[model samples]
Target: MTPITRSTAQLYETDFVAWTEKTVQLIRAGQFEKNDKSELLLSGKSGNKRF
Candidate 1:
């Protein structure tokens, strides 16, 4: 892989991990906001209780 592409992928992975951790913390603390909760309710998943 190209150096630039590899670096970008690493950065994206790190950001994604950090975001997931923060989201979990918010959920555990009952601090999740309505707008953010809407985003987490993945369309069809919510309909089927897949979450």
Candidate 2:
């Protein structure tokens, strides 16, 4: 996992492609701590789910 820098929730709708690319890059880099787990999780799902 790689973490991306904090971004507003609106950014996902405003530029989904860029956001996805940035997210992929961050994950590939192994910067897990920077990723926003809450934002990534589906509503009603537990954050404890792990790979």
Candidate 3:
């Protein structure tokens, strides 16, 4: 099976502002399914401010 890849994965690492903009846009547009759930969940687990 193919892994669920995140389009914003690199942005999350390189550009915090861009990543946040994209994520907020995705959420506001109700594109919840397109979000990187695994990444967010992992961030939540780690209590990361960057996520």
Candidate 4:
């Protein structure tokens, strides 16, 4: 198989933000888990700490 080159990889990387947003949307829609550690790390409104 042919290797993915730097330019091709860069193109994908440029669209990564949009990809991540779509993934999160899918997770929220119950399609899958978000796998979002940052969201888990944020403090809740009641000041509860989350791991």
For each candidate, the alpha-carbon lDDT, in order, equals 0.70, 0.66, 0.70, 0.72
What ranges in model 4 sit over 4 Å off? Answer: 1-13, 33-51
Query: How well is each residue in 1-51 modelled by candidate 2, as lDDT tens digits?
Result: 665545755666669777677877888999867766655644346644533
Q: Cα lDDT of model 2 overall?
A: 0.66
Can you write out model 1's per-residue Cα lDDT over 19-51, one digit (the tens) per residue? 778888888888867225634645474473323
lDDT of 4 by residue, 1-51 (tens): 999999989999978777788867886898755555454444678785765
Best by lDDT: 4
What lDDT score goes with residue 44 in model 2?
Answer: 43
* Model 3 TM-score on a 0 to 1 scale: 0.46
Ranking 1 against 3 by TM-score, winner: 1
**Candidate 3's residue-wise lDDT over 14-49, tens digit each?**
687777788789989999888776556434655864
For TM-score, the strongest prediction is 1
Worst 10 residues of 3 by lDDT: 42-51
User: How do the candidates rank by TM-score, highest first?
Assistant: 1, 3, 2, 4
Score residue 49 of candidate 4 by CA lDDT. Answer: 72
